[model samples]
Target: MALPSPPLFIVFNASSGGADAEQASGRVGDLLTAAGRPHEIIRVRGDEELTRATVRASHAAREAHGAVVAAGGDGTLNAVAQVVWNADQVMGVLPQGTFNYFGRTHGMPTALDDSVAALLSAREQAVTVGLLGERVFLVNASVGLYPRLLEERESAKRRFGRRRVVALLSGLGTILRGGSVLTLELSVEGQTRVVRTRTLFVGNNELQLQEIGLRHAVDVEQGRLAAITLQPVSTLRTLWLLIRGALGRLDGAEGVDSFAFDQLVVRMRRRVRWVKVALDGEVLRMPPPLVFRTAPRPLRLLLPAAEAEEGSA
Candidate 1:
C-alpha cells in the first residue's frame, strides 16, 4: 500500500492528555525522515488555534497532494477531520490520547514508530462518520449524563492525571452522584416514542460499542448508528448499569435500551434553547432538536496496511 507521494502535514496539540508532545513529534519526525517521507509538524497551543492550524494544514496538504495527520486525542482528530473532510483530503492519525478509540477502532498503531511506519505505507479508505446536526463525529455523540461524565472526567484528569484508572474513577463518581433526567421524544425510522432518561448516546464506532457490550455494534458496519438510552433509575441501579457497561455485559442489562438506526431526531419535552452535547469527548452547546445521523459522505481515512487490505477484502 502506497500513500500519496507528498509531505504529510501533521497537526499536533501539546496539551492533549499527558503525553509529551515534543518527544512524540520528535519520534514521528525521525521515523518519517528514516522513511524519506517529507512532513511538517504544526504544534497547536490551545483549542482556539485548532481550526486555524487544521485549516492551514489542510490547505498545505491539498496543495501538495498530501494528507493531513492528527497527532493528538480524538478531539484533535475530530477537528482535523472536519477540515480534511471538507477539503477532500486524506487524513491520518497518530494516537496520543488516554483512550484512542478512533485509532484503535481503525487498527491504527498507538506507538509512534509503528504508526508512522504504518502511515508511510497506508492506503486511503472511505469510512462512515456520524453527524451531530452539521458537525462531524468519528466516535460517538451524546447528550445529557454522558456529556457530564466527560466534563467531570476531564476535570479529574487535570487534578490527578491522564490515566485510564483516573478516567474510570471520575466516570464512576459522576454516575454515583447522579444527574438530571431528560424527557426526550425520540423519533427513529418513522416511529416516535417519548422516554425519560439521564442520557442519550449515539455510537458510530463499532469497537466502542463492542467494548460496552452492545450487539448494536454490528449495525455501524451495516451503515447504521447504535443508539443507547438509560431508563430513569435509582443511583444504585445506575451504578449497576455502569458496572455492566464496564464488564461488557450491557446488552441485555435492565434499565438500558440499545437499538440501531440510520437517523434519529431527539426533542426535549421541556423547553430549552440549547443542549450540552459531547461529540468525540468534546462538550459543546448545540441548539435542539438534536439530529444524529450518518454523514452523507464518508471520510477518506488513511488506514494501515492490514486494515486497508481487510477493508478492501
Candidate 2:
C-alpha cells in the first residue's frame, strides 16, 4: 500500500478549528521526512487563499504524479477535494476539524501522527461525493435554515472559540430564534411535490447520517444520496427535534421526513434568483433550481491500509 512515489503536496490551513498550522506542518513534515517521502507544505489562510493553494497544489501534484493532502477541517478537505478531484489526482486527508465527518467516515485517523502514518501506507479508493450544480460536497449539502445555522455557528466559534459546547449552544440559539421556512418544489424519483420546511439537507456520508440516527445512511452506502427536511413546527418543537437528534433518535421523530434519492431537483416556490446554500461546512449563495446528485466521477481518496482492506473485504 505504498503511496504514489511523487512528493506529497500538503495544503495546510492555519486558521481552521484553531489549529496551529506551524505545529501540524512540522509534525507532518517530520513523519514524511522520516519515511524518506518527499513532500511540500503549502500554508494558506482564508477561503480565497485556500482556493488558490488547492489549485496550485493540484497542478503540482498532477505534474509530479503526487497526491494533494488536506490538513484541516471539513471545509479545508472540501476545498482541496474540489481541485484534486477535478484534476483527476489522488487526495489524502489529515483531519484537523471539529467534526471530521468525511475523514472519519473513510476511517482516516484524527491524530496527526497516526493520520500521517496511515497516509504513508494508504491505498487509493473511489469515494462518492455530492454535487450542487457543479460544486462538490464531500460530506453534506443543504439550504434554508441549515445554512443559516452554519453561519451563526461560525460566528459563535469565532467569538467563543471552537468547541463542541459552543457549537451546540450556537445551533440551539439559531433554532430557538427561528428562521424563514422554504417553500420548495422537490423533484425526486419521478415525483414532484411542493413542501414547506425549515431546511432541506442532503447527506452523502453514512457516518454523519448514522450519527443523527437517520436510517438513510444505508441508502448513501448503496450509491444513493439521502434527503431530509423538517416539517414547519414551532420553535419549541424544533428544539425537541434537536434534542432527539443529539440523542441519536431522529429516525422516526415527529416533523421530520427523510428519503433516499439518486437525484433531486429543487426550485423555490417563490421566484428567486439566488439561494443560500451550505456545502460541507462553508456557506455560499447559489442560483436555483439547485440540482443535487452524485458526482459523475468519484474522488480517488487515499485510505489507511486497514480501512482499505476492510473496504475490499
Candidate 3:
C-alpha cells in the first residue's frame, strides 16, 4: 500500500514540553527521516507566533498540500486547527503535552518515538472537530466551573507530571462538589429547555464512564455532540453519583443525565463579564452566550494503520 501522499506537517508550541521541543522533536524527526517522510518543524513562541505559524501552515496545506500536525496540548492544537480546519487542510496530532486525552483516546501513541513512527505510518481518518465561538477543539468544549479550574490545573500539570493526575483529581473535586449552580437555557433541535445545573458539558464526542480516572470520548466521526448537565442537589448525593462513575457503576442513575445532539445553544442565568470555556485542554472565555455546533467529518486525520485494520474504525 502506498502512503497517502507524503504530507508537510506543522508543529505548534514544540517547546510546550517545558524545557525545549528538542528531545521531543529530535526523536520524532529521526523516525520521519528514516521513513523518508517530508515535514517541517516550527517553534511557536507566543500568541503571534502561534497565529502566524498556523495560518502559514494552513495555506501551505493548500499550496504545498499537506497535513498540519499540532504538536502541543489542546490550546495549541485549537489555535492551529482553527486555521486549517474546513480550509481544505487535514489536521494531525503529536500528543507532546499533558494528559493527551483526546490523542490517546483516538489511539495516538504517547511515547515520542513510537508516536511519530505510528503517526508517519498511519492512515487518514475522517473525524469531527468542535467549534465554540470561533475556536476549534479536537475532543471537547466545556464551560462553567470546570474550565475555570482547568486553567489553574494545567500549570500544575506542567510543574508536576505531564500525566496531569493531580489536576484531574482537583478538577473533579472542584467541579462536582464545589462547582457553581447556575441557571442555563438550551436550544436543541429548535426546542428551548431551561434548567438550573451545577455544570454544563457539550461534547463533540461523549465521555465513557467505564474508564475510571480516565477521559475518553465517543468517536468524533459520529456526527453528533453529547451533553450532560447536573441539577443542584445534596452534596452527598452528588458525591455518590461521582463515586458510581468512578467505580464504573453508573447506568440509569437518578441524578445523572446524558444526551446527544447535533447543535447546542447555552446561556448562563447570570450575564457575567465572560464565561470560561475549555477546548481540548486550552482555556478561553465564552462571552455571555455560547453557540455550539458539530463540525462532523471536518478534519481528515491520519491514524495508525493497525487501528484501521483491527476493526477499530
The model with the greatest lDDT is 2
Candidate 2 lDDT over residue span 168-247, tens digit each: 89999999898898899999989999999999999999998998899999999877899999999998899889988988
- C-alpha local distance difference test of each model: 0.89, 0.91, 0.70
Off by over 4 Å in 3: 1-5, 15-20, 46-48, 158-161, 172-177, 206-221, 308-313
Number of the candidate with higher lDDT, 2 or 3: 2
Clash counts per candidate, in order, are: 0, 0, 0
What is the alpha-carbon lDDT for the whole of candidate 2? 0.91
Query: Every model's Cα RMSD, please?
Result: 1.7, 1.7, 3.4
* Model 1 / residue 149 / CA error / Å: 0.7
TM-score of each candidate structure, all chains considered together: 0.97, 0.97, 0.85
Evaluation by TM-score, superior candidate among 1 and 3? 1
